[model samples]
Structure formats: C-alpha cells, structure tokens
Target: MDQPITRRDFLNGIAIGATAAAASGPLLAASMPDPAARALPGASPLPPAAQDAFGYYPPLLTGLRGSHPGSFEDAHALRDSHTWPTATDTGQEYDLIIVGGGISGLAAAHFYRAQAKTESRILILDNHDDFGGHAKRNEFNLDGHLNILNGGTLEIDSPRPYGPIAANLLTTLGVDVPKLIKTTQNLEFYQSLGLQSGVFFDRETFGADKLSVGLERGPLKELLAQAPLSAAARAAIVQIQEGNIDYLPGLSSDEKKQRLSRMSYEAFLRDVVHVEPAVLNFYYARTMGEWGVGTDAVSALDCWGIGLPGFQGMNLAKGSIRRMGFTPAGYEDTGGSFRLHFPDGNATIARLLVRNLIPSAVPGSSAEDVVTARVNYAQLDRDAAPVRVRLNSIAIRARHIGDPKSADQVEVTYLRGGQAFTTRARGVVLAGYNMMIPYLCPELPAAQKDALHKLVKTPLVYTSVALRNRQAFDTLKVHRVYAPGSFHTYFHLNPHVHVGRYESPKSVNDPILVHMVRTPCKRGLPEHEQNRAGRAELLATSFETFERNIREQLGRTLAAGGFDPARDITAITVNRWPHGYAPEYNPLFDPDVPEAERPHVVGRARFGRIAIANSDSGGAAYTDTAIDQGHRAVVELLQG
Candidate 1:
C-alpha cells in the first residue's frame, strides 16, 4: 500500500513498544524471542562465513533490546567518582556528552574510549532503550533458527571503498581486509546468501524484444539501460582485469560529479552500459530492495557512486563467484567470505559500546543506590530521559551558534513518548536523516532545508513474510531471483539455504521466511495525495493478503516447475516497516550553506553542548557513514 494503514487485527497489531496482539487466524503462534537466540536462517552462521555472504545476520525479528541511557549513566557514576561533579558526586557532567544513541552516537562512544584509554568522563544519552536508531535488531524463535535477526541496514558491499572513518575501524578491529578480495570464497559466499540470481536476456545483444521468459519488452531501451547492476555486470567482467573503470566520462572531476545526479538510475545504466532491457529490470529490483528507490526516481550519480566507479551496465554475479569470469583468487576481500558482522548485524556492536559507557552497578544494591532501572520503548512518554530510555526516540535538533569558535559546544532536543525534551551538551553530532533536519531545525533557512529535501531518499516498507513447511517450488532450485511486478525479494531459508549447509541443520518440513521490501510513497501531504490510488489498493494486503499473493505466485511457479501445493504449504509471518528507508535518491552538493540558514533547534542543540548524528544527515546512510559522522562530531566538540 502507498501508505501502510495502521491495523487492529494484523499480527501483533502495530508494535507501539508493547506486547503484540495475535492475528485473527494463525496456524502457528510466533512470539518474540530473546536477542541472543535469533539468527538469520539462511547463509553463513559462523562469524567467518557471516562476513562472506550478503544478507542480514542474527535477523531483527522484533522491537529493540539492550541498555538504556539513565541506567548506563548511573553505572558510570559509581564506576568513576569524577563522572558526577554535582552534589551526588557521580559521573554526571561528562567531559564529552553525546545525545542520540544511534549508530553514529555509539560509534563516537567507541572511538572516544578507544582513542583515549585514560577514563575521560563520557556520557551518552539516547531516548531509545536500544542504541542503533534506524539500525534495529529483532529476535524471534519460530522453527529452529532462533537468534537476533537484523531489521534494518541489512548488508554492506565491497565495491564502494570504506571511507576514512570506517577504514580506521577496520584497522582498529584488525579485520583481515585482504580476505574479502578473493574470488573462490566470494563465489561461495554469493551461493550461501542465495545471491545466485541473474538478468535473463532474450537476445545475446544489449537491447532485446522479449524479457523475463515471456514478458514483452518495453520501448524504453534508453530508460532500461540506466538500471542497477551487479558488480560483475557493470564491469562487463572486463574492467576489473583492466582496472581502469574509474576513467569513464563524467568521472574524475568534482564539479561535474552531479552531472549524473539528476537522471533516474535506470537511465544511467542504459546510457553507460547499453545492456538488454530484461537484465536491467532484474538488477533494478535488487537495487530497489537495497536502496528503497526505484529506477525512475533514483539519481544516476547515486547509482554511479553506489556502484563500481565505471562499467555502469552489468548484471549481478550469479551461480559462481566470477566478477567478470576472472578468478579473483587474489581479490578475496571483494567476495563473500570477507563480510564482518555481529550475531545481530551491528546491534551487537551497539550493545558492547553501551555496556562500556554505563556504570556497572552492584547486583543487589539498596533502594537508595538502586537508581531505578526502566527500559521500555515508551519510556520517552514519561520524559523518560529523566528516568531511563524510550525505545522510539526521534531527535529533532542540535546546534551551537553562540560559540562559533567551537560549534562543538551545542544544544540538543529530541521527542520521546511523543513529547519534546531538550538537553545541554559540550558537543552534538546530528546522525539522523537529512529530511529530519527540517523538523529539528524548524527555523533553518528555507533554501538549505529545501535543497536538502531534494536529496530525499526513496521511502521503503519491508515486510518479512514466512511460509512454513510449504514446498511449492520443490522441483526448482531453492534460490532464484524474480522479475519485476513480482515480489522483489523471495528466497528459501533453513536446512537447504544456509551457509555451512553441512553443519547447519535443514528443515524440509519447517517454516521458511521470505523477506519482501517495497517502495512506499514519501511522507507529507503531497506524497499521500499523489499516491492515493495506489494506497487504497495496497491497503488490503494484510498478512493474509501477502499469504494469498505468495500462494498465487507459488502456484504458478510450482505448476510450471512441477511440485505439490497442498502438501507443501504451511504457516506465515508478516513483519512491516512503515516509515523506513532514507528519502534522498540523488543528493545535491551545496558546499557552502549560509550561517543564517543554520538556526537554533529545539532538540538538535543545547547551548553548544549536545549535537545530533544519524544517516538522517547528508552522506551515505550506512553503519560506516554513521561511524564517520560520529568521529567528525566528536573532533568538532573536542576542538571547542
């Protein structure tokens, strides 16, 4: 649906940081499980293999879980006396106080502690109980594979080199970067994640009449070429061996960087690679699921930046791990085996960081020293910052105009429990999305906010649908990529699909989850009005609606492939993300923003002491980007 309607009868109806209600009729009851126990069912279980494959590890099946801000600070107070300078003599007035405990916030915490081993008072305040903001981790115990599953920021690719900040972390963590470059391991990694997909072309040449087995080819050959492509396809499996893809036109220059920034991603692919229309659509669907932007809206610059430097037209690697038919034995790190992750994506990292920041209170302390410990998603309603954490805390502002010499010292404010609360800090790092900037800094110059708004990321809604013990495509291979108009993401999970298949148990009769992410219209009245027709039609797709769709698709595929329907189908679980995906498709580069445009915000800044940070700001909205921004924010603060 264009706008996912809030439902009352849907499974665990609208998780508002509370117990979920059951759906109207369900064959199997799936309750939220502990974070430590829920893991991604298919592809790589062990940490080593985890890095090599693409897909979320430790599936985020439910709401957030971990330490809250209040308790965390109290623990620090008791652990170090200087932390609390007030009458209580606890760690309160920190040398460095960070607001908004998202990925960037946590990464800042990690960087500060790691850089300066000397226990400098550091306090991190997040409205949410869990650290990662958009990067949420969920846990569910359904059939057998029960561990922390990732709900957002699913995977990281290698073609895009890590920025300085992320590279620094990799060095600090001592991850073997070279391993990811190799091919044998990378190919196996692709197979493990069911990335064994390809663009089916009707003709050997670039533009063909027929596509996807029987679908008629659209007349938009030029448009279709500008779609997303797999690394191998873009390089034409040729440029990698030559290593000169970066010399393409519209590249190697800063001014013209935005040259490809205006057109749709599909347009860029067609203009660059001159590939077949069918292959373009296949790759386009994968990109849509990954970036939440369709070919039409996504910018060519973003497409180029996100993809390998040049070689714009290409298909994703499939079956085997040959980028361009070359055995990238030396480029292991680019392959699947080099992926690094926590059991539950980066949420594990957030937990570790949160633990280090909080004071370690004694197990059985008295009521006086007990410092009330409350961790709930709704704590923000109680002005919970005074108490503890509110799960869904959204930050609105952070800035420091009074002290231009050091913008580090700042004021910040955020909304918790649906109410606004402000805090003061020595430094503030805004790590939220760019669109959120307008709301946080309401007084910001219209031009700046509007320009940033132009960089709005395509909005997306992800629905994780699980079908239990129903093998409709038994005859077909377990993994296969679908064409456009069909569900964007669908793959088998458990026994047959996971990495380390030999060691991991299989489930012929167990439930397998299929994750489907669709593009949703942007927020605000304009988008809603524009998408009213689609919204009405899509609103009917409840868990049952999804089940019926899958059954319909499965019936067609199975009938063609030859498989039993009734005996194979089992149960289903549907998880929805309404306000997901960043809004910017192609970002505009405005190097200099006027000072007047930067206004004091309610939650964004507090007397140059607190700042905000999230992918909501500019730059690629990834875990690494958040980390880089965190480091930049801290550096700015320390300088002041």
Candidate 2:
C-alpha cells in the first residue's frame, strides 16, 4: 500500500529524519513556478514586470538587481524551513559536478580534465541565464554596427607576476601576451584625442555643477585658488600634490607606518594633516571606484598603497613631490601603458575556456578569434556531451551519498525552469560566492560555516550606455571624469583596442560605448556592515531609478558641450552586482592572523568528495587567484 522506495523518497526520508519537520506548503508554493506555463516558448525566467525591454536578465523591477528575487527565494525558503523537495534523480551521473559556472568553476573543469588525463564527464550549474559570471560582456547593434563593452572583470593585470600555476593556465588558454601588448591602445594616443582626466562637482554636493580639466595648470588650480576654503586647506592640497607631509612630527619610520595603517584616510587628512572640511570632502570620493568605499572606510596605508598622496614618509626629500597617479604599487606602467585587453574585456577568457571544455558550445581556435565566436547555447547541456554547462540552474543542496569517509559519490539538487532536479557525481566543487555556501551545505561543521559567513562581498554597478556619437565628450574636452557625489562615481569612453576582427571607432561621429561605474558604500559604517548596507541599497534600486539618475547626471554635466541625453543616448544596460568584489584583508577590521589560521584557509579544507574554489577562497579578487584556487580545489579532490 505504501509508495515504492525511490531515490527521491529515500532522500526525503533522510531529510525528514534529520529534522523532524515537514516542508512548509506556503514556502514551497511561493518558490515553485507553474511548471506547465514555464514550458511555453518565450516564457520569462522572471516575473513579467521584471523583464526590461532592452536589458539582459530580469531587471529587478521592484527588488534587488544582481542576485534578484527568484535566484534566492527558493534557497532562502529551504534554509528557513529546514525542508526541501525530495530531489528527483534524473538517473544522470558525471565525473565531476561544479556548483558554479563562473571563471573559477570553468577552470576547475579544465584542471580536473588535466588531472585525469582524459575528457571527463563534468556538469557546471549556474543561477544566471548567461555564463561568464562577473566577466560579463554587453553587446549592442546600433545603426547596423556592433558595439561591445565590458560589464565587469576588465583586464588581466600584471601577467608577469602570476604564479607558475596561473601562468601555465594562461598559456594553455592560448593567451598571447606579446600580441596583446601590441594590440592595446596607447594612453598618449587617447590623450591626443582630447581625452584627459577631469572632475565634476554636482551643484547639490559642491554648490555648483562645475567641470574642471587640466588640474595641474589650467582651470582646476584656479578654481581651488578662488573656491571656498581656508588657507590651511589650500596649502594641504598643494602639499598632497607635491608629496610633502611635515605635519606629524616625532615619529620613527616604523611608528609612522603603524599610525597610518591604523587610522582612516579621512581621519588622517582631518586630524593629522589638519585639512578643512572641503578638502576632506574632495578626498572622500577619490577612491570609491577602486576600493568600493570612501576614504573613511579605508585606512591611511590603503590610501598610500593606491598611489594617493599621503605616505610622505616614503618621499622624505623636501623638494620631492609624489604625483597623484592612478597606478597601484608594484604594477607600474609597462611602456607607459597598463595592460592588454579584449574588446569585451576578459569575457574572451571565459569564452576560450568554454570552447575548450565543450567544443560544441563555441567555435574558436584561439583567444583572438573568440571575440566574434557565436555560442550555441542550446547545445550546452546536451545529454551526449561529456562536459556541459547548465545556465539558469541554481544549486540548492549538496550532500554526500552515505558515510563521509567511505562515500564514493556526491549528490547535488538544483532548480531549473521552476522545477527541481538531482544528479550524482564522483566529486563536487563549490566555486560560487562564499556567503551562500553555508545555506547550500548545512551539514558543514559549525566553525566552517561561521568562517564562510565572515566573508562579505562588495556591491558594485557597471553601466554601459550606447551613444550616437562622441561629439559631447569631445566638446567637453574630457574623456574621463570622476563624479565624487553622484549616483555614478565615474564615467569614461570604452578602451580603444583594435584586436582580432574588431576595430575601434575611428571618427568622432562613430557610435561609441560609454562605461560608468558605481560602488554603493554607505558612510559611517564598518567595512562588513557597509558592504551589507550597500547590498541592500543595490537590491532596492529599480531600473527606472537607474535610468533617471543616468539621464540627469549626464544631461547636467554635458549641457555646456551641446549634448542632448534624450537624442544621443540610444540604449543603456545596468549590470548590478550585489556580490561584486571578493573579500580581502582589512587592516582596521581583520586580525593579523597567520596564513594557516585564516578563515578562508580553514573553511576551504576538503570535506569528503567536496572541495572549494573561488576568489573568496583565496582572499584576493584577481583573475589569477581564481585560477589558482580552481587548480588547488581540483588537486585536493584528486588527492582525497
């Protein structure tokens, strides 16, 4: 009379036995979509109102943007109720099951194949509709011509400093460093095109919507000379530009370093340097683009590390002045240029990895050709393929099949098109964001779960706008401008790199892409708390709000340049990432723990057939870190 003991029932029995409670009906009903309706053609993965007319993915019409509602609802419901559907085993098995389809997970598949020395059956599942994760590419067809811009993960910084494993991975992926160097745009050439650094002060924030160019000689210095500021503030500005710091006395070199490392840059500028409020205001907005927080959240040492004018102790000579350069330390410009990049940024790397792992998904032989390759999305998860990537599939649960020591297989359950499905694998890799791991695998040790939770992802928004021409930018005589107190912190013309078949725009009238960056960090909050508040703000923002902000900011700033936002701006794509940058060491908040005792190192220890891989696992946000972590995870699983 009882139902037969299928795998799904058995798993459900195990879950129910573990926690003596049934699945909540309302939660399950709220999370699950109508399966019958979802099967229809062109049915949106999100609610109808959330889909934008032009933008990719659901636009988060009312809720969060990056990690939107549907992506987290089911997982949250399961976690809260301590119940999930009995995973219906599809009877499919793989040699490896990767929990993310980002660069790290893709690299894990590559490393696993190399270790086995054979083409292994691997499955990669991602919650997003598209692959590449944060290395996103936005393409537009304007006036019958293709315009591409990077949505995130812009470049491979300082490839020479890469570790042996990372360098070898780059070589294996067919990245020609010499060829890339040759193709990258020269900075001097950009400056020749009347593109130079400038700053814009909004009327609301600085009492005037004024644009200042040529800070060294022309309007900027004159404006500072005549603007509202005390004599001490003006002197401090000059001292900062000239790298002269004589204010703090009676301190040894080590003592000065320790003081700077402990104090906030804002505090150092106001308290130590004795700068006025206006000067502190100017300094606050300087580092938002790179650090995701203002000067207050970052320490004085970080300010100096990013080439900000603060570490006068390093340049003790009275006549010597440290320039306000953008380049980070140890990454000086090679031949007066930063690094090479593709037209669509590092998305080319993701494309190359996909081509190698699943040859049928893309058609490309080298990195150069990958820029224009057409991917066959329909073939990604085909049954016949040895390696497959399944998009719009969110993994909700992962567990060992039997005893931890003796279990030979791991099972993973995920949601696809509103339905739940399960698959088995010889090994599993958790290569997604660190915060979500605790909810996915509740069986992890309490300390490991707590350590994983300690990682807080920085939130950022990268918006690209397609324009009819570059006349406005040229008229303004500035290609890049930093907006200190606006919704968008920075805006610039796309990098002019002519590589492969893609050619950079030549004429001023040619359609060009304008990229804007914004990192949401609330002031007066601790590092982790600020990240949490920023994530909430990002989620609460709507597409309409974003569009409105963009229009107002551009129109006001470019009005003097004869720019009409309504006529020139053709399209806008806002790529909101709630979990953008990976967690790194914070001098103010994080303890000076040894490498062996760090949370990331302890949490990443291999557990049975499962291993961890991601930028967060390595405590750095570089592309090489992701690759190294992937390699380590694969090696760990093989040895275990």
Candidate 3:
C-alpha cells in the first residue's frame, strides 16, 4: 500500500472488521482453544453495536468484507469435510426455515408467507454480517457527506429481457425501474463536463504508459498516436473497431452463430481476422466486466452479443446465441435488461424486500425513500415477527427427522460465533451456494449430492474507493478508465444516482466514491477451471496484498492526471467473494445435455419437504433469477 498507510491509520481510519484471528476453516474441536480467543489485532475497533449484530450495519464497516475473517469459518468447517455437531437443540421451530439470507432466501420467505397461513413462521439464516447475498452495498462518509456505491451485482441486466415471475415481484416490492432511472440516475452528468471513457495502457503490457481519452470519438488515427502501441497493433485496433468488413460474409446468421459458439473471441480474432499478437491482449480483458473471464474463455457469439469490438461488420442478427462458457450474458433466468441499477445495486431490492417483509426493519413506504433509510438491524430477527432474518449464522446440517418420503419436520443445525445451535422447520429452503448444499444435507441422495458438488461459483471482487477528490478525473476528462493490465480491470467514478434523502457529490474538488471490478482467473483455463483457480487465489490473499495491488494500479493509471494515491485516497472497501457469482452452466466445461438433465436442474429437484432456491438453482447469476428461483422453491414446498 502507500507509505501513508500506518498501524494507527489501519486502527483508526480504516473500518476493517476482520474480527477472529484464526484462519477461516472448520470449527475448532470442543477441547481446542476458542477461535474468538484469537481475535485479530484491533478487531473490536468498530462500535460494539455493529459486531455480531441484529443491528449489524455493515455498509458503514469498510476494508475486508464479503467472506471476511469471522463470516465464513463455520461454512468452511462444513466444506472441509465433516458434518458439524448438532448436539444443542435450541428448542425453537419455524413453519419454514430458509438457509442463506440473500436475495433468494429473503424472497423465499416472502413467497412462503404469502402462500402459506398468515401466521406461518419463517426463519432466514445468512453467514454474512449483512443480508442481500452478493447484492452488497458499500457506504462512505466523505467530508460530512454520505456516499453509497454497489459492492457487487451491478444493474438489472440480462441478455434476454425479464420474465414474468421476476418482473411481477419487482412491482410488488414497489421498484419502478423506469421511474427510478429517470428520477435517480444522471447518466450524462460526467458527459456534460466534457468527460468521456478512456483506455489506460499500463507500462508492463505496452511499451509506454498512457491514458488515451475519447476513444473512437475523434479520428482513430490521431488517438492511436497517443496510445502506447506499435504501429501494426495500432492500425489493427483501428480497423477492428471501425472497419465494416463482413468477416463471415458467405455464412447465414445462424451458421455464423453456431461457428462462433464453438470457438472463442480470441480464436476468431487471431485465426480469422488475423490481428496482431498485441491486439489480442488489448481485447483480452474486454469481456472481463460482463463474463468475468478474458476473450480466450468467452465464446465469440456471447462476446458479439454483449457489444464487443470486431463484430461491427459480421452483421449477425442481434439475438440470443448459445455460449460455450456461461449463459449469464444473454439469458432471462431472472429479470430483464433494464441497464440501470439502484445506487447500491440490487441491495436496494433486498432492502425493499426486507422493508416489505418486516415493516419496522426499514422505515419507508416507497422505493425512493428506502435508499437512505437507516436500517434497524435489531428489528430484523424479532422472535415475535412472522418473518425473521438472522445474520452471522451458517447452517451446517439440514436433515429430515424421519423417512424422507413421509417426514413431518426437518432438523437444521448451524454455527455462529463458533457455537452450534439446532432448530427445526416444517419445510426448508436451501437458498445458499449449491456446492455447499451437499455438505449441509448429507442425507440427500448420492446422485443429487454429486450433481450439487459440480456447481462451482466464479470468484470476483468489487472494490469501493473513497477519494479525497476526483479533480484528477476531471482534469483528465475521463469518466471511466479501462485498465487491461491493472489488478482491477475497470475503475470509474460512482454513478450519479441519488434518491430521496440521498444526494450524489457533484463537485470535482469534493471527495467521491469510485467503483472498481476485479475478476481473478487464469487465462488458459476453462470457465469452471478458472473459477476454481480464482477461488483458491482469493481465499489465500490478504487485505494488505489487495491494498498494495490497488494502490499501485490506481497510481500507475491516474498519476498523469495529478492523482497522488497516498494523499488523495481516503478509504477502501474490498468486497471479496471467494464463492462469488452463482454457478451458470458453461457448455465448454459442462456436459451437453437437455435442460431437464442439466446438473443445476437435477440438483435443484425438491427433496421431500426441502427445496433449493438461489440464482444457482436456475443456473444464472442475476437478481431476477434469484427471485424466480425463490418463488419456485416456495411454490414447490407449499404445494408438495
């Protein structure tokens, strides 16, 4: 990190809630020392109200989040290969118990309550300190002004439009997508200041470090002169971006798509278009923002569908095409392609769901006011409420009390703060990671367990940076910078979104929040192979390592803009998810089979009274899919 980062700064300025000193692994044996006994240095620096909280306000907490030190130890223990102990029966029971207090889990409770009796008791358990699952929110208080940005899952976009189930639920939650886009988001705010998107060529990749602003806006020949690129590479990029030559001239649209699906964008660009080797590197990370992988892994069809360069002349009919890696790019497993997000991403939808489920938890009647409403986390899991969301709880074992075919109740055991507690529910919804479900419910059929184990999620990170000022960005006339060689593939000023009591910082001299995205993966590996490798890499990495990389990356990208990392950067919140984006089937790494025979479908089959719910169950990573799966799980359990 920068030299200004000191032990005192870590303790005071950075709100890192690492908590437990012990590594995130299986629970310690009863005779072993308590994990809590080995707390990280200054673990309790934050206010007491935020730790192990019902009043857990994680947005205010910064630094290490999303699989933070204390969050995943219990789940890790279950994943490390043994069913945790279920000795202590809490003697508490619910009509319905939903594992994973994410969007799908919360939605399951909502649907369960609506269909079941009015008094039906529902319990939602989540391992993280906050709800919303991957729909995370990051908040910063800069110079007395509160700024909010998305920590994960930006925008309600899918290749296909939203389905009925997902769309109706959004309406029920009072989230008017079009109205919110108009009233809240100012997409042209930065453009109004003559600021445009730019590409930063790092010194390592290219011969020289350079940030070429207003790409393709002016003469490509002139822009290429300033970029750090060889003459051949520069000429190739210009041709790829602007030339209107039909690469697949003789083939029909469907034939071209079929051919594209079988090959990668890199293959198409290299073998077919015959671009220079350096040109390949330029387009490598282009798909990283959407697919979380390089052009080498993503199919040419999927890349073309999501508007990448080099396809302008292909003239392929604009439609959903099969992808070899994953179908997240253009499928409608969840919601539609709205192209707008709440300031804090889908966290607003989660908050709205919570507000609707438990009126007092979030005090707002409309969607607009919910943005700035102070969540009373204490009111979330009230014993008296029909719906309760419990955080910092990891469900370890979920098994039927008797024969699966005729069981009346399911017993659930979970770990929190290193202690185990058991409870029971008439029906259960497993809305957590599909890969972990097999570990949670061992009594499940062997084939089902095997299928669930195949669901490996992509690991990614969304880093929120609080800058002392965005004057550097203003001076550079850059709204967003795509750094192909940096630790973060993309970094841009926070979207101009303000709702009700919330307002965005408009001054360049004022501190601002910047959002950066990183998807760690090996280039040559298959989609799932990259995901698994990235997962290992993320779990083994430290906050300090992340900080150092982030500092070095931002410094190199914006130094010419007069940005000084040590002085201008105020705070950083790295939301790291080792088991991020729910597993979406990729044809490249998966068996070619019918939709019903797919692993996710076969795995999600209802087991007696226990049904699966999550974006994983639907085989798509979107908020809409999460909602649809939750609704399906509830209907299956209630009507079964």
Candidate 4:
C-alpha cells in the first residue's frame, strides 16, 4: 500500500484537515508517564544487531517507517534542552558533509562532486535506516514476485513547471518523465475494468455505511439519491456542482479572487455560496491530503485553484491573486509539469542519484533498470567510496570550527551505534528539517534561528497494505474512495504500473497493494498551529491504533464487496511522517510578508561555510523545489 499520498504523492493529495490531538504534545516532556505507559502500543521490537550491521536492507523492512524508532530519540533529547555531546574524533575529514541523505542532500553531493575536485570526499549522515528522506520505497515479496510501492514522495511533479536546473537534473539522471509515464503507467487499467472513483460514507458520520461509486464519472443523481445527506445539502451540492450563478456576482474577477484569498474554502461554500453545513463532508478531504488542513483552514482561492465545485460561476481568471503582501498559489500554481511515478515512486530518483554519486550502490546505468535493482546498502558508507552515505547516524550537532565570520572548516558531531564521533568538513549543508536547524547550529543569529523555528511541518501517515487480492475494490467498481470521517480519509488500489523489469498484478486473484492517507489536523487553529497539532497527534498515535482503524475502516467500506480485512491483509507498512510535507505557504494563516523576508528565505540564507537545502527551505512540498534548493545551496557555498 502506498503511504498517505502527499500532493506530490502522485495523485495530488491535498485534502480537508481536522482532528484534535488525542495525547499531549510530544516535545513537552513533563506531562507524566511511566516507561510502560509511554511505550508506543505497537512499537516495533529492536531488530537483531546483524540486521542493521552489514545486512541492512530497509526497503524490505515493514511496519513503522518515516521517522521510525531510534531515529529521533537523540534529536528529541537535544531539542528538549540543548546538551552538547562530547565526541571522540574519528580522524576523518571530508570536503563536504551533508546532514541529510534525502533528495536535497543527495543532489547537493552530486552537484558538489561535479563542481569540486573528483576526489573530494563527501559524507551524508541520515538518522533513518535508509536514505531518500521522504521518498521511501517499500518492498514486499509474496511467493515469488515482488510488490513495491512508495512509502513517501510518489511523483516527479509539482504545481508548476520544473525549473531548468531541476528539469535538467532529471534528464541527466536518465529519467525522461514523459517517456517513463507512457512506458510504465497504465491509466486505463481501472477504466477498462469499469472501476471509478467513489466515496464511502461511514455510519458514524453519514448515518449509514454506504459505498457510492462513479462520483465523478457516473450520474450525480445516483450519488445524491444514495447519500445520507440532508435534503438541503443534496440540493446545495447540485447547485454548487451543476449551477452557474455567481455568488460574487458584482465583483470583478481579480476583486473576487482577492476576497477569496483572504477567506477559507469552507467559508466560501457556507457563507458565500450558501451551502448547507452537511455538504462540507463531501469536499472536506480534498484539501487535507495536500496541506493537512481542512476547507476551514485552506484559502477559498486555493479551492477554486484546485477545481473544487461552486467556482465555475465566479469566472475567476486562471491566474494568481496578490493581497496583503502575499500571492496565493491557487490558480497561478497549477500549470505544466511532467507526471511520472516509478514503481517505487521518486525513490528511483534517489537510487539513480546514488548510482551516479557512488558508482555500484545501485548497479543499473539507466533509470528504467533502477526500478528492479536491489540496492547494496553495505556499499553505502564504505571508506573507499569518495561519496559515502552513512545511515542510522544521527548528527547531534554541526558547528563551525571557530568564529562565525572566519571559520573555513566545520565540525559535525553525530551519534551512531552508541558513541559520538566527530568529522571535519570544509563546508556543510544542513538538509534535514528546517525547524530543527536552530538546535543543530545554535550560533546563528537570533532572528535567523527564530525564522527557522517557524517552519512547522504538517504530520501525516502513508499506509500500505499488501492484500491477497483486490476483489473487494473490483466488485465495488471503485478504484479509489474518499472517506472523510474515516481514520484514513482516502484510499485506493495502486494503479497498475509496469516498468523496467517489474510488472504489477494483472489478474484479479493476484495480490495487490492498497494505499491509504491520513492527515491529522486540529480544527480552528491557524495553519501552522494546525500542523503542529497534527504532528503531536501523529507522534502519540500507536501502530496498533493505526492498524485497528485500518481494519475497521476497510471492513466497513468494503463489506458489501465481500472484503475481509483479517484474511486479505498480508502485510502492513505505516509510514508515519510526524514532520511530513515541507511547510508550504498558505495565505490564510501565514503572515503577508515580502518574498525575501519569508521564513523559508530568511532561514535558508547561508551561514559562513554552512548552507541550508531542502523542500522546507524553499517553502514548497515538491521534488523540484528540493532539487532547486540543493543546487542553490551548493552554488552559494562554491561561490564563496
């Protein structure tokens, strides 16, 4: 199963967000609890030492991912209250040492090698068991064939066209997005099978557990007739979807858009369009998957930008809106970008980069062959490799060797196994969480540090379930479902993708992977606050809770189709991203500030020999942004 589909998670998951924290904020430690009380219900048992030692294969590992255990304990301890750890010098040095092994970090390494000397040794330290940051690839071997799905970043896409640097980077990696999409994706497979998009109204939220198929393709009358919505809601939905009367009739397109930019999508529907409250459920989850905030938290302009209903009559021009020193990306953001999702999503990009940077790590020479190539994790951090990627290594501190203005080298102290080791580098790139940068390098200016702290990431989960078969979905004629009230708001059978040497299941009896998405956000709070609350909720949620909800929701939604959760689920991988999507700018909650003064911009400014890079630093949750940021960070350092 694919993890919570991020907007870039391929299908463009941006949905309604609302859900209060069930437990206290994870950072504030004094809440109270014994060891047993605090233990996560389904916290995975520590794998054997050898498993992570030389046989480290994280793609095959299932269960909790995306900030898995032993990954964040040190960072948390340091964040709670800074206690710098003393380190034993490793007598090792590098030209560059990147603190993240995600896309941006890998790209930084690739760029550094290209510009610097060929023998310039670079090291990428990551806390996770595997690299690629949020672009995670999950693998499941059933009987003989392998089932693969992305646990995180899913597509080489964005709201707008990829800039030259990012676009050229993909081409250089042998990833022809258009060519790959044609060769790998089967968009008509579900259509041929007569399946369509649907909604599952649970009894708790809709008064009855019902599945309504073809909500987009089939007759709207059938859905209206079957929905347990109030009569007023039914009529309102029809008017919104099919009617043409403009709510903001008198205002010009720009004026209407300006007003929309300042309000939430929910307000546009309820107060402006005069829709009944019950109608919100039908459209709530659409925005949740993208930013983890519901219609109430999202800008009305954004709803219109994404083709949400009730906007046709307004006749707003297909463009952007600027108000109060900010530009809303709704209409302006959606444009051309090649969409390509590999068998393992953007992890193919990571593997391709790894292959380019560290020769034999991923053997294949082309992006096509990389789909089925098993990575040699053992070779990742070899001493002989000029560019080494060290996993399961948490960098506790990255500080300049001396004064702010004069330091030419940096010291990076990290915890791997149980001891602290220090490595020196000519320059360093902090490519991890933007919010955590303040803790890593405390010597930065107070305002810069403060700016970095404001980049709060939205928390979410991407769950993948390996099923015995997709009979339930096929029977119900639903390739996807939108369940607003369910724990997982959206789920679907992964589209059949045949690429390289890998092929998706072709038979109804063949095993399939179902992907589910959950963005836990609290209502009423501002966007950043909502994201913070969502992160806390995700941190407190147990895999047991996740699994139970998965079973219950699937059972209820697919019962009519004879789906049996207990018997059909062969495996489950819950990719919990407590700090999920990189915080994107939102006109509703974020302050209207000049572009250069924005948190991402101010925070990303180079500090001496240190530079920042990541999608977070760019304030856009897309692969292109990460690549762009990485290139920029590298260029800044090289120029100096």
Q: What C-alpha lDDT, on a 0 to 100 scale, does residue 586 get in candidate 2?
A: 70
Query: For model 4, what is the C-alpha lDDT against the true structure?
Result: 0.79
Q: Positional deviation of 452 in candidate 4, in angstroms? A: 0.3
Alpha-carbon RMSD, candidate 1: 14.0
Q: After superposition, how far is residue 540 of candidate 3 from its true place, in Å?
A: 1.3
User: Which of the two, 1 or 4, has more TM-score?
Assistant: 4
Clash numbers, per candidate: 117, 2, 8, 21
Report RMSD (Å) for each prediction in the order shown.
Answer: 14.0, 12.1, 7.8, 6.5
* Better model by lDDT: candidate 2 vs candidate 4: 4
- Every model's TM-score: 0.56, 0.86, 0.90, 0.92
* Best of the two (2, 3) by lDDT: 3
Task: List runs of model 3 lying over 4 Å from the truth.
Answer: 1-55, 82-86, 321-336
- Residue-wise C-alpha lDDT for candidate 3, range 421-539, written one tens digit per residue: 88899999999999999888888899989889888887888888889998989888987877776677777888887788888898888899988878887888898898888878888
Winning candidate number (lDDT):
4
Error of 4 at 588 (Å): 1.0
Model 2, C-alpha of 236: deviation from truth (Å): 2.6
- Residues 13-111, model 2: lDDT tens digits: 000001111111111101222223223234323332111122322211211223545565665576576565566677889999999877899999999
lDDT of 4 by residue, 48-155 (tens): 222224445688777777788778888998899856557778888899999999999999999988887557999899998889999999888875789999898878
Pick by TM-score: which candidate is best?
Answer: 4
Ranked by TM-score, the better of candidates 1 and 2 is 2
User: Predictions ranked by TM-score, top down?
Assistant: 4, 3, 2, 1
| Candidate 1 lDDT | 0.39
Q: Is candidate 1 or 3 superior in TM-score?
A: 3
